[model samples]
Target: MNKKGISMILGIIFTISLAGGVKGIKVKAETNNFTVDLSNQYRNVTHVASGSLYGLSDENKPSDDLLMPTKPNVFTQMAPNGGQLPNGEASPTGDALKVAEKAERSGAKINIRFPDMYKDFPYKWISLDDWNSKIDSIVDSTLASKAANIYAYELWNEPNWTWNAKTSGISFNEVWKKTYDRVKAKDSKTKILGPSISLYDEPWLKNFLTYCKENNCLPDIMCWHELGDAKGVIDVQYIEEHVKDYRNLEKSLGINNRQICIDEYGVTTEEAVPGSMIRYFSEFERAGVESACSAFWFRPGRLSNIITEDGNPNGGWWLYKWYGDMSGKMAMTTPVSQTSLNLDGMASVDSSKKTASVLFGGADGDNNILVKGFNSNKFFNNKVHVKVEEAPWYGVDTKLSQAKEVFEGNFNVVDGKINVPVTGMNKSFGYRMTITNKEGYINRYEAEEAVVNHANKFSNEGASNGQYIGQIDYKDSYVEFNVTAKDAGPYNMKIGYANGNSQVSSQKLYVNGDMQADVNYDSTAGWMSSGKSGTKDVQIKLKKGDNKIRFSNSQNGYAELDYIQLSKVAKTFKVRQEAENALINNATVNLSSYGSNDAFVGMINFGDSYVQYNMNVPEGGKYKLEVGYANGESSASTQNLSINGGENKVITFEKTGGWMASVPNMGYRKILNLSVDLKKGDNTIKFSKGNTGYVEQDYIEVTK
Candidate 1:
C-alpha cells in the first residue's frame, strides 16, 4: 500500500491529447482562510449520467433488460440525455465517447455508472472462480479508448443499496489486488485510483486499504461518494461539513499521505435520489463547494447523456473539447480579473491589486502547485530530478512536454509559456493542455500506445494457438505472424497494408519488430489511423523459430490474417455445473428445514464460466437463473449458451442464441421446473458463452 514504492519511467514523451482543462473563471474562495485560488475545484458540472443513460450505440437504444443475466432487484428507468433519448448500455462506443467529449467540452468530468444488467456483472465475485479476465478486459478497454477523464473506477454503484445491504461487503482487498495486477500487466504509468465507495462508514477506508495491503492492492488515491441528507436547505447545507469529514476519514484510516478525491459528493432534496441528485449538486456548488462532476455519458449507451442538445450539455456546466471549466466560489468582480501575469505563471490576475493566481498542473505528486500565479500570472522554468537509487520490480518513466516539441533529456522551455500554444487544435478532441508531465508508473493513461499501437484482436489462420505464417493482403487494420528459423540471416517482411506513396526514406525498425513509419491518421496504421473492428490482421517478425505469435489490444477493432503456424495448442474440456446443498426453505413456517434454496442459494455467485456439483432436491418448483459476460460475442445471433439441471425437478434450458450477450441487453432466459420443491433437499444449474457462455447468475431465489 506504499504509494511511493513504485518508480516512474524517466524521459518519456506523449503526444498532446485530452484537449482543454477548466473553464469560466469562477471567483476563488479562501476556505478556512486558506488563501489559494482553487477555483478549478468548483469548475465542474453536476449530475453525471448513470451507466444506463450514456448516449452511444448504433441508435439511441436503451439496453435490453429481458436479456439480463439475472433479474435486477430494482426496475431500471431509461435515463435520458436531458430530453435526448436512450443510448446503448454496458460499454462505451464512439457516440458515448463523444458524449464525454461533449461534456468535457462544455466543462464537465463525467462519471461511468453501473447499470442494472439482468446478467449481474459484479455478481461474478460471489462465484468460486476468479473474475480477473473480465476485470482486465474492462480496464483494458477503458485505457485503450481514452474515453473519459477517468478519475476513479468506483466498484459496482450503490452496492450498499437495500437489495445489496444484507449481502456481505465486497472483499475490496481482492478487487484492488486483482485490478492492480491487471493494470500493471499492461501499463506502468499514471495513477490507478479507486474502490470509490458509498461512504467512509466507520472503518470503511481502514478496512479497505488493510485488505488491499494484506492482499497486495493499495490504491494511489482513496475515492468516496457521499449521498448527503436529502431534504437539507441550501444555506444551511451541512454537506460541506460532511465532505470535510471525508478528509478526517482518510486520516483515521492511516491514509493521511494518500490524496482523497470525491468521486461523487453532492446534495439531494428528496431522499437523495438520482434526478434530485442533479439539482442538489447545482445548489451545493453555488453555495461555494469544491467538487468534481459524477459525469454523464462517458460510455457507449443510448440512455444517459448530460447534454440533451444533440450531445451538448445543458446544466451547471459542460465539457467542450476536454477543456471545460466550472464556476469557482470567489464572489465575482469582488476581485474577478484576467491579465497577462508574468514570471510566477499566474493563471489569472487583478491588475489593480497586482495580485495573480498561478496554476501548476502536473501529474507528479510533489505537490508543488503554487497557490498564486507568479505575481500576476506565468509559467516558471522549473527543474525536477527524481532520484531512484533503489527501485521496484518494474521501472517508471516521466514525459515532460510543452507544445512545440516533446522534451526528453532536457528542458525545452524558452519563454515562460509553451513554445507553441495549441490554438486551433481540433476542439472535438482535446489536444491536451499546452504543457504536460507524463509520470510513467504502474497506473497509466494508455501506455500501450507508447509501445506500438497493436490490433485489438489476434487473427490466426492456423488451427493451433502459437501458429503464425501469413502472406495475405494487409490493410492498416490486420496483423500477420510466422515461425522462422533461428538461423542468422536477414528476413524481409513486407507489410500487407501500404500507403502506396512509397515515401521510403527514413523508415526504421527496432529490435523489437516494432516498425517505425510516419503515422498517418488518414492512412492505414493502427487505431491512430485505421479504424477497424475486432479481429484484424497485423504482422510480426521472427528471427528463427519456436515461439507463439498473437496480437495485443483488440479495442481498435478486429484484425484480419493470412495465416499462422508455430505449434498446435492442446485442447481440454471441463464440464461445468452450478449446485446447491439444499432447496429454498419453504414459507410453511418450518424454519428448521435446510435445503438448496435455503441459506445456500443466495450465497452462490457464478463468474467467468462454471460447471456443477451435488444436487439433492426435495420438492421442485419453477426456477429462474440468469448469466452475463464481461466482454465478448456482443451480437445477439452469436450468443452461444447452455444450461444443465440435475436432481428432483431437472429442466434443461432451451438455447435461444443471444441469451448471454453483452451488457444492458444481456443474455437471459427463464426455466420451468415444477419438481424442485425442495421442502427438504438440493438442486444444481450450470452455464457459459463465447466458446463459453459469458453468463452471470446473481443468486437463485424462491418465493411462496
Candidate 2:
C-alpha cells in the first residue's frame, strides 16, 4: 500500500481507539506503570517550551495574552515580504518584525525562514542576486531593530523539496554557503540555522554537512522538519532514534555536535490532540533537543491548533500551559513502554517551592505513577498532598477551561515512594499529577444561593454547583454571600466564573461594602460550556463572625458566576489595597474600564504625586509587594516605592500597551512584584514618581 493508504488506515484505527470503541476487538486493559526519580535530576524545566511555524499572522492576531500562557520558546516565521499561504493569498512577512517584538515581550524567541520570502510554497527560484539582496535586507533590518530574542536566521526552509539545483544554476550546497557567508558578513553575531529538510534523511543531512564543513559555511544550529506524513498522521515514534542518528553523523563528519532545532513538527490530526502532542514533547525533551515549533498545517495565528479560530483555548493549549507551569529541575521519568507512542510522561521537582509535578498521557486505560527518591525532610513528612487533574480533548473548535482536578487527597510517602493509581484514563486527554507538601482546609459556597440583586440565576450543566448567577452587566448587579469564619485572618477566595466575552472580563470584589480587588476572568470556550469555567484566586480578610463578600459589576464588569471557594491557608499573607482608596497627593482618581472598582490613580507624572496605603499585618517580616499598574507609554515607567517611610526604591513598571484597556481585543492585566520588608502591625506603603514617565496605579497586593 502507498504511504497515504497506510496513513489513512492508521488514522482510522486511532480514531476508533480514541473514541473508546472496542466492539468485536479484544483489547487488553492493563495498568501502564511509570517511574519518576526525584533525586535524578537531568535539566531544568524549559518552561514547557514549544512553538509554531508561521503561527503568528500579525502582531495582535492571537494577542500576546493568548500566547503568553503557553510559554512558547521559539516561533518560526517567513522572512520579510514572505509567507505566501497555501490559498494563493499572502500573509506577507512585512509584519514579521512587529510580531517578533510582541513575541519577545511575551518571553519567546523567533526564527526567520529566508526561503519563505519567495511567495511560493515550493518557492520559485529567483536569481542569486535576488536571494542575496533579500538576505542583506533581513540581516540589516534585524541588526538595526536590535531584537535580542531573534534567535536564528534559518538560511532556507525544507531545501530538499523547495530547492532545484538544475534550475538555480548552482547546487543547494553552494546556495547555503553563499547565504551563510552573506549573513555573517553583514552582522557576524546573528546565527544562521539550516538544512531544514522536509523530514529526517540521513544521506541528505550527511552530504549537506560535509559540503558545508568543507566550504567553511556550517550552520550555527542544525534544523529540520518532522511533520509526520501528508495525511497528518504523527510518526514521531522514532524521533529519539533520529536524534541519535544525527549525533552519530555529526561525529563521523568530525563536526562538533550543534544544537538541534526541529523548526516545524506535528501533523494536522495530532496538532490539537493533547494526548498525541505529549508523544512529541516527551521525545523532544528526552533527546535534549534545544527547541521545536509546531507545524502550521491548517491555518495561521491559532498557535498551531492549540487555539481555535474564535480565539479560545482548546484542550491542547491547557496541556502546554501545564507544561509551561513546570519550574525547577526536571526529574527522570521512565515509562514501561517507550518504543512506540504508548504511555509516557515528564516529571519535574521544584525543591524551593516544595512541589513536584508529573504530566503524563498518550495511551489510555489505567496507569500507575511510581514516584521515588524523595527525602522525607526535604519535600514531605510522612504524608504528602496529591492532586490529579486532566486536560480533556473536547475537539479542536471547542473552548476549554483550565484542567479539572479529578482527585485530591493526602497520600502516605512509604519509603520515599508514592504509587499513584490513575484509573479509567481517556486516551484523548492529558493528565497532570501534582505532589506538594502544603495542605489547606477548603469551604465551597454555591453562587446561585447567594443573594442576587439585579442578576439572574440560571441552570448550567457545566457549573460546579449545577446553577450560576449571570447577567452581571448592570452597574448595580451583584451576588452577595454572608458566611461565618472561625477566625479573623486571611483566606484564599477562589471565584469560579465563565466569561465568553472576547476580552477579559472583570468584577469588583467587595468585602464588607469596600472594594478589595478586581477579579479578572479570561474568555472561555463559551458561556457556561461544559468544562470551560475559569477561576481566579484572591486573598480576603474576614472577621471571626459573619463576613459579607460580594461580586459586583459596579465597575463595568460582566461574567457568569458559578461558585466561590474559601480555603484557610497557613504561612501565607496577602492583603490587597485599591489605589482609588489610597491617600492621593496631586493624583486624580479616574473611573477606569479595567482594574479594581473600575477606578485607578492616574496623573502621577509629577514628583510630588503619590498614592499611599496603610496596611496592618499580624506578623510581617518580609513580603512580596505587588503593584498593579499600567504604563501605556512607549517605554517602561518607574515609581518610587517606600515601606513605612523607609528609603525610596525605584520600581519599574513595564509598558502595558494601554492603561485602561486589555491587550487590544484580549483581557490580561500586568503587575510587577517586588520584595519589601515590613514590620508587624500597621505599615504605610507609598508610591511616588521617582523617574519621569506616566504611570497609572491600579492596586497593590502585599503577600508573604
Measured by lDDT, the strongest candidate is 2
Q: Mind giving the per-residue lDDT tens digits that candidate 2 earns over 1-704?
A: 00011111111111011111111111112446778888888887885346887777777767776788788888887776664663212446424576888788778888888777676667898799888888888888778788888889998878887788899899899888888887888888878888889899899998999998999999999988888754445678778789999999999999999999998887644665777777788778778889998876555777776786578887888988888888898887886675666888788888888899898887765566788888633756666777788987644555786777655545556567766655446666888988888664325566876899988877644454346788877878889987767788877666667666555567777888877766666555356543344555567888887889988884543688876666565666678787887899999986432344335788887868999998877586888888777788888878888888999888888887666533121222466888888888789999998675778888888887
Worst 10-residue lDDT window, candidate 2: 1-10
Candidate 1 ranges beyond 4 A from true positions: 1-130, 142-152, 161-170, 213-216, 230-236, 265-291, 295-704
What local lDDT does model 2 show for residue 360?
88
Residue 187 of model 2 has an lDDT of 80
- Deviation in Å, model 2, residue 574 alpha carbon: 39
**After TM-score superposition, what is the CA distance of residue 512 in candidate 1 from its true location, in Å?**
88
Per-residue alpha-carbon lDDT of candidate 1 for residues 226-265, written as tens digits (9 for 90 to 100): 5442332222233345446655665665654565444444
Instruction: Write down the TM-score of every candidate.
Output: 0.31, 0.59
How close to the true structure is residue 88 of candidate 1, measured as C-alpha lDDT?
34
Please give the CA lDDT of all the candidate structures.
0.28, 0.73
Count of residue pairs whose backbone atoms collide, per candidate:
140, 1
The TM-score obtained by model 1 is 0.31
